[model samples]
Target: MKLALVGDIGGTNARFALWKNDRIESVRTLAAAEFATPERAIEDYLSALGLPLDSLSSLCLGCAGPVSGEDFRFTNNHWTLNRTAFRNALQLDNLLLINDFTAMALGMTSLRENERIQICPGEAEADRPALVIGPGTGLGVSTLLPDGERGWRVLPGEGGHVDLPIGSLREAALWQQLFAELGHVRAEDILSGSGLVRLYRSICALDNHVPHLTSPAEISSAALAGDPVAEEVLSLFCIWLGRVAGNGVLSLGARGGVYIVGGVIPRFSAFFQSSGFAKSLRSKGCMSHYLEGVPVWLVTAEYPGLEGAGVALQQMLDTPNAA
Candidate 1:
């Protein structure tokens, strides 16, 4: 019956809610640009919810960066936090901070039967490691390692910043072009929201057409409206995503399931379903059969970050050392 405050803090938005009695209540999302500091945003959310400061037993935050000691700075936003200071200010017994992808990996545990849709066909093994990846403002990667009776523990890292691998002659050309312009073409270079735009522009230039730079939404809309260039961008995006996912699966030895959790994937589900995703995933030369039985699923749960925070807090409370 413990009450906790949970937040999924990202580059663009910070979502807050109260986890009470195994459920989230008073969920609210605040624009990161609207608040100068994280404390200010917390205060505003608390005021909006009319929640008492003393009622919160713990505060758990899923941040979009590497957490070191008591301080962590957001990857996309300008906000920084000193965890010890925040805990003291809130007068809470505990504060938990974890990488955002770690939150997503943990969030997969709370997913409902109806909340997820299978993309690739496979027989997922029970008690095996699970991988969760997504592309939004940036690409994220994390895996859930089964810890026997302790459940799954999240293994998070900066996998998205790794070097991108080109699968074809066309991709090689695009990669060279991007490398020339950006000095280094990372996996996130053409795998994120801004990457969608970059792909569209790169295609425009490749075909000797004037590139009208647009947002990811515009590109998606244009692709749906029968724009050949936009369609190509999405197609390329899906292919790359699948290839990277396949590599991720092999690297992590993930057999339970591979969960796709991000804002961008759901936006173009139909295209992703019909695109070269499955084919590309199984296209790995020597390891083709290794991923044959590993299932791929898209996470459609609402407010998974908050739920993930709740899971982290429950784990903390369960630990004997915490007592």
Candidate 2:
């Protein structure tokens, strides 16, 4: 029997699972910092399951950062992998490495209705592309395009680093401070986990309010507890996320829908559902109506990246000329 392993590796954590019978099993998440290299982590995972290292015939990793060349270094961590060295070490017949967000885009294929929370209700045009944007350690953006005979093709880019769009006078004021301090304020600068703290601090400075919260969790907790300053920060964070999501949809014509997948939003799902996000998303001046029927969903699946790794692997192994 041909056995395969799939992994969704990020800066903070690395989730691994066995791919069998078209599903994921024996799922495990390991701290990225604990292992010297990704290979060691994989070996440790297999060993914990009492499985032989050579039992796996194929390995697929959906890793953070650009995937190319023989030598691959993780973006947020110190781990690196030499593809040829890894393939030889593992005695694998096939090895595939994909951008973590590309795997995230592919993971949307397996989402069931209950697995997602609808942020905006509308009909999805199945033939059009879908936008997948989320924030964790950083913001990630990718487009899932219909490939006709090829099923789906993922278009991955550093859309997170785009200029931060200003929507209101208050936001413009915040931007001025951020730009003054950081020089260039990218979308990821305000939409990520750490970005949440940055936004909170900047807001405090603008309002002459002493910042009582220093982390995303603390800010979110304070917001939920009805602290005025924290509440404003969380609200603006969601609104800005909406603006960015709107931009992505317009750029890709992603009427197939929008899947918001990441760690940050899900932390405050209820707050996000009721925030100004919906209104901000459709706030485009003349093109507002263009986004009318575009559906948006917040993904709630626990291991989507790992599941997407499996999908990517299957696609690659089945296609003879895939590159």
Candidate 3:
């Protein structure tokens, strides 16, 4: 049977799947760093599946970069994708390109009630916007705007690159040190997996203590195991994440609530719930009361972006100009 191809390409991993009549089949993931190019990896995946590439009619790709024309380049990687070339390489009739976070936002519509962990208890206003932010290999930002009696329109954003505002003297000192080292401080600087390690080292540096910083996974493990320094790092990370999330909510005027999507938050959901995330998120000086009414939800769906790619493909097919 003819199938639709869907893929979510991120900085570290790329998830590929075959969608047949709204159902996902033969899903697979590959390390993007292991391959020289995205097309080569796709070729390998198709070859391993024993499927003829030419038989697929349409392909939808959600990539970790801004979609520009027929070619897309990853911000955190060296891979560049040419849609025309990819189409020619795979011999597909139709192709769709989308930002990975945009795909995730669209995928929100398909999420089941059970797939979300509600962090706040307010009723969502359908007329308001919904915000989505996530910390993975990198930070992603997007928003769902109401579409005037229709559903919602997803807008992919680069809010992660916005300047990180320091709220306290301690945070300001940390920011100064980070600025000295990295030149510019963005939300992604302290809101992603690598950002966790940076926060740990920076905190340790302030205390004149030597930090044995390692990978994000190692930091998370130590924190979960009750290591004081690691725990401190995780705490700061959660607080800062909440602060940035609050900024996103304000920027979008998202009364529908905020949704966290990424591999990082799922690792320590309990800690996130109990940590300073919520407190900091709602701690805007004069706007605390306003922010308190906005709820937060953790997206717990697996392969959400893949599901989004399917939705995107379907939308594309239904569009009048999508021959």
Clashes in each model (backbone N, CA, C under 3 Å)?
0, 0, 0
lDDT, candidates in the order shown: 0.85, 0.92, 0.85
Candidate with better lDDT, 1 vs 2:
2
Q: Please report the TM-score between candidate 3 and the true structure.
A: 0.91
lDDT score, candidate 2, position 68? 91
Give the 10-residue window scoring lowest on summed lDDT in candidate 2.
314-323
Clashing pairs in 3: none
Query: For model 2, what is the error of residue 219's alpha carbon versus the real structure, in angstroms, after optimal superposition?
Result: 0.5
RMSD of each: 1.6, 1.3, 2.1
lDDT of 1 by residue, 51-81 (tens): 6666667788899888778777898899988
What lDDT tens digits, residue by residue, belong to model 2 across residues 1-323? 66899999888889999998767899999999999988899899999999888898999999898999999999888999999999989889999999999999999998887889999999999899999998988999999988988578899999999999998999999999899889999999999999999999999999999887888999999999999999999999999999999998888898999999998988899999999998989899899999898889999998889888999898888899653
In model 3, the Cα lDDT at residue 268 comes to 86
Better of 1 and 2 by TM-score: 2
Misplaced by over 4 Å in model 2 are 321-323
Pick the lDDT winner. 2
Model 2: pairs clashing at backbone N, Cα or C within 3 Å: none
- The better-scoring model by TM-score among 2 and 3 is 2
lDDT of 3: 0.85
Q: Rank the candidates by lDDT, best first.
A: 2, 1, 3
